[model samples]
Each structure stands twice: as C-alpha cells, then as structure tokens.
Target: MPLYFYSTREPYGEFSNFALYGVKIDGEWWPTTEHYFQAQKFEDAAYRRKIRDAHSPKLAADLGRSRRVPLRPNWESVKDDVMRACVLKKFETHSDLRELLLSTGDEEIVENAPGDYYWGIGKDGSGKNMLGKILEEVRAKLKNAAC
Candidate 1:
C-alpha cells in the first residue's frame, strides 16, 4: 500500500493537505513524476499565452488603463501548466520528481521542476502524468529517475 498526501476537496475544489493511496499498474505501486515536471512547464507557458491574448480591450482598459499587468501564474494552475510545456526527453518511473522526493525525501527534487513547485506525492493519486492526458503529471515528470 503506497502512502501519500491527499487533498480533501472535491475535484475542481481546493487541494487536499494529505492522504494515502494504492495502484495496480503492471502490479506496480505508482506511475512516476519525471516527465510530469516537463509537462507542467509547458502547461504554464500555454496558460500564460492564453490569458495574455484572451483579455478584451474594454475589460483590459477598465482594469488598468495606462499600465501593463503581467499576472503571476497561480500556484494551483502552475502545477499542471509546467507539465504541459516540457517536451518528452525520456519516460521513466523513478525519474519522476514526485516519486523521488516521496520515496527518498530529497530536496533536490523540488529544484528539478521548471518553476519550483514542491508539492510531493499523494497517497491516493491515480499516477497521472504531465501530459494532462494522464492523471499524474509529477509521475511523468521524473523522466530520468525511472528504471
């Protein structure tokens, strides 16, 4: 049984603080978090691009008439944003940033991510990957750590 932190809110709600989890992929406990980071990086870039051009001129003027407002990426949004931006160099489990930190408790894992979001493994995740196609972005982020 894999142990991890789980958010208590429902999907689209606030993130959970901590929890425990399990999986059945290839009889493996979890997916991984390597490529997940890359995925997150790309996601953020894409998100910025979206909002940058999405604002209406009227609303933009009302908000700020003479100044540019570069809104910072929200922590929650960045988690998935960074994952989408990274191109796949390699795919592996142990390489996952989340897995490495969770399994080994290494601080270096946080630095490995593109932007530096340090949220670690969850106990009840479905092993989603960064592609956002998968449920675990961190799992896919550790491209080099998997064996």
Candidate 2:
C-alpha cells in the first residue's frame, strides 16, 4: 500500500508540524485539511485580514487588527463533515485516488494510523480502526453518487 501524508490538526508522536504539516496515510488513507482560514477566498474579509496581518509592517502606526482570530475549537465535531467533503472532492478531481478506492473489492479497507491504537490497529494489529470504517462509508457514498 502506498503511503501519503494526511495533515492533522494536532500532532501525534514525533510527527508534529505547527506551521503546516502532513500525516502519513497508506493506500487506504485519505487526506484532509483543518485550516479553517485557508479554506476560503483570499479576498474574503477574514482571509484578507489573515494575509494582511501576516504581511504587516513593523511600525506600530501601520499595525492593523487581524481578523485571524480563532473560531470555536470544535474540530472534533466538525471534522466528519469536512472529511465527507474532502472525500467527495478528491473522488471528483484526483483520478489516482479515485482509482485506488474503486479498485478495492468487497473487503473493508483499513487505514491504520501508526500511533493511534483506538482508532487504528495497535502495534499488535488489534483495534477498532474507526478511520477505516469512515473511509468505507465515504466510498459507499461516492459509489452511490456515481449511480
């Protein structure tokens, strides 16, 4: 199975990147982003403010308020919706990703996160593997969408 990076909102183990980072995903893996800011039009008020603050002048007189203020930290609840959108978008655009998923037989695909024993197979390969289940559900949705 091919391994790819799937960004996480928070770091896991030694794999940490605050500015921007990617998580490792196998062939059964899916990638999604949680950057509530970047996922917007640049010209939008909040996005523009983020850009402006990041590129602000050093002078106090030139300092402008940034609209990059954090929103409610409810990613845990919102992530499923985000993931669904990502799966649909990827299936629509990335032919390789779509082919990888479509190539699967009736067998349930498992994407094991290396460090997550509850959500992935543990070091001994025994766990709930919820992410894998989510992938399966997303795949089914995609298949139904195509029909």
Query: Model 2: runs farther than 4 Å from truth?
Result: 1-71
Q: How many residue pairs clash in each candidate?
A: 55, 1
* CA-RMSD of model 1: 15.6
In terms of lDDT, the poorest run of 10 residues in model 1 is 12-21
Q: Candidate 1 residues 4-100, lDDT tens each?
A: 2222233311111111111122232221223223222332445433323323322322332222443345635664544333222222321342443
Which candidate wins on lDDT?
A: 2
Tens-digit per-residue lDDT, 1-147, candidate 2:
422222334322111111222222222222222232223222355543443334212221122223344433564566456545544554555555555666564456554456656445655667666555655676687678778
Write down the lDDT of every candidate, Cα atoms only. Answer: 0.29, 0.42
Instruction: Report how far residue 119 has shifted in candidate 2, in Å.
Output: 4.5
Error of 1 at 40 (Å): 9.1
Which run of 10 residues does model 2 get worst, by summed lDDT? 11-20
